[model samples]
Target: MPASELSVRPLTVADMTRFIEVDNIAFIEGPYSPDLVAWQRRFLEVERSIGLFDDEEQVGGATIFTMRLSVPDGRLVPLAGVSWVSVLPTHRRRGGLTKLMRHQLHDLHDRQAEPLAGLTASHPGIYGRFGYGRPTQSVTLTVPREHNTLRLPQGVDDVTLRLVSPKAGLEACRETYARRLTSRPGMIDRPDFWFDFETDDLDQLRGGQSKLRLVLAEREGVTVGYAMYRTNELGPAKGEVRVNDVYAVDPAAYAALWRMLLNIDLTIATVVPGLAVDDPLLAMLEASRYGEPALRDGLYVRLVDVDRALAARTYATPIDVVFEVTDEFCPWNAGRWRLVGDEKGATCTRTDSTADISIDVRELASIYLGGVTLRSLAAANQVTEHTIGSVRAASTAFASDVQPWLSTGF
Candidate 1:
């Protein structure tokens, strides 16, 4: 069908039921509750909700969340995140998906949202054409029941883990997560994001079950860490436990929380973490007896606006470098940006001079959170450094020792 034959318009409040229906048909096994649809519509706004309709029938829908990310230098940058992308099976191969995506991208560009756009792709191969690249990795780990013990270092004391109601624990979890997410690149939090981030998605692999428990780790009467998990029977003599989400303010608390989860009695011989990448839990263990860890790509980020995205996160070290970013999907971000940073922080601004390093926007997105390094990109020829010292300096300053982990699935 020609793009002109289908109407792509802003989703209105009246389309809620049809929207949910289309989403349900598209996702099939996923959760698209009325309450969730209502909350998402309100939180994201109708203007951000674009739908493809064939003669008033809603065939597909996509939602975008707008927010700012605080950089290491305390600079807040604008970012656009894509979520809830769905299309009816009958609408497949039609121009509905393309129209919706094109319209949304145009809208974002018009808004001058230069920081970039991010999303978790249902089909990894589909979004690359839109200049989206996998910037972060997620890991799933299964540890044998025996290797679950954790040895803590000194000065980490009084760690207490307790169960809390999901509703009651939402605020504490959100607060702690906000603090942790801002410093990490490629992580963006919406203003009314509390609902999705705090609430469980009952349909996802790790979500949707009522038996899942929320464990809050407290120290000195303050909640510092939390985990969402559930236990199930794996076999006749074995049981399995899975962690949906887990986070802590400090290393000790994080380790203690894991230990508590592992030590759960009557359960199978092992525990699994739903989403983890380069998990510290592995290092904290005494040996490699832990179950095998599997790595998978998580979020794909596209910088709609380069300057705003680069300025949003704080850096560990101070350095100056120029990046020639090629954004094929979003033309606005395709250019050279001079990023200068010091102990005080960093700034990303357009420059006409020669670039010290040249890379595609996808490569930058991959390293935006300091997870991937410039050297790796250079090795892959994803990045080309003009100056010898500049590459090392920029990579050292921008790279993060700790890999970023997204506990919530969009």
Candidate 2:
């Protein structure tokens, strides 16, 4: 198998089975069940998937999902979701993975729809070489039931909370989730297939836990928030409730939902899998002897269209700066760009002006959502400051009032 003979192309309908086999082999996972394969066929866009082949045999592949990303100031822009990426073990180290990724980027660029591409990294070191940066941090918090006290906010009780079957509450949850996506940064819009997968076909993936329970909060018959969770046994007298998904549009609704999770009967501890670093639940806890929160990388973002991505978000303050960004993978993003904006809006244009800061596209993406600051990058020697006050000004302008968080991982 000569490297020169390797080719990457979109998967066809007839290539579905071979693609799945390559995916399972590359990931070292057992063969997917027949039912799972059928589900994959339903949601997977064969045209958007790439197959890396040596001669006529598939050895590597990946898939892209059309998605919407919620950026700063509640701007939802089209995004490309990359997932199910793999290179067969036998094909590793032969440049197959690189070919697949480069081809994927070029295809996305040619489409000209999504300005940004995002993926949750399976390995920390793989995507950075391709110009992806982790912008959001996800925290996993475990609170003992005894310490799950809610110092209820005034009027929180006015919000009615009730338990409903996942089947019955799917529509309301979908509407509330749509509102949450528009109002929050880093959230991704969920498609109908996603709802179907989460509510119906996800039990087998839940590790033998009880069936998922849906909790909804409403005021005047309008859905405001929801929580989806499952309980597992910790011991005879104690149990653990794992919250899979949660969304709240209003403060009272948010507080009310947490109240329900904290007070679920027979559960001695609650484990929240993914929450923002600055989630309000941290401050809402009245008292607790909880362990330190475990923080991990959330979304890895790639700025496919630098100008469009930079101009789409609102800044925190007025500032002007020129950045020389190095993006070897996406050569279009390389060079100096002048960005001028305030809290209302921003404009980014190509410039020959002297660069106030020299950085890589990965570094730029890290701070794109305002979760990681330029100051922090400077401290780590990841950013170079040419002007004395430019670093602070740039950091402040890009800062977000609420930390960026990904509501869903593709």
In order, candidate lDDTs are: 0.72, 0.86
- Residue lDDT tens for model 1, 326-406: 877678788889998755656899999898998887777777766778888788887888877777788788776667645
> Tell me, what's the RMSD of every candidate?
3.4, 1.9
Could you tell me the TM-score of candidate 2?
A: 0.94
Report the Cα lDDT for residue 353, model 2. 92
Model 2 regions more than 4 Å off:
1-5, 288-291
Root mean square deviation (Cα) for candidate 2? 1.9
For residues 280-370, write the lDDT of model 2, one tens digit per residue.
7888887633835789899999999788889988888898999989999989889999999988888999999999999999999999888
TM-scores for every candidate against the unseen true structure: 0.85, 0.94
Model 1: weakest 10-residue lDDT segment is 201-210
Please give the lDDT score for candidate 1.
0.72
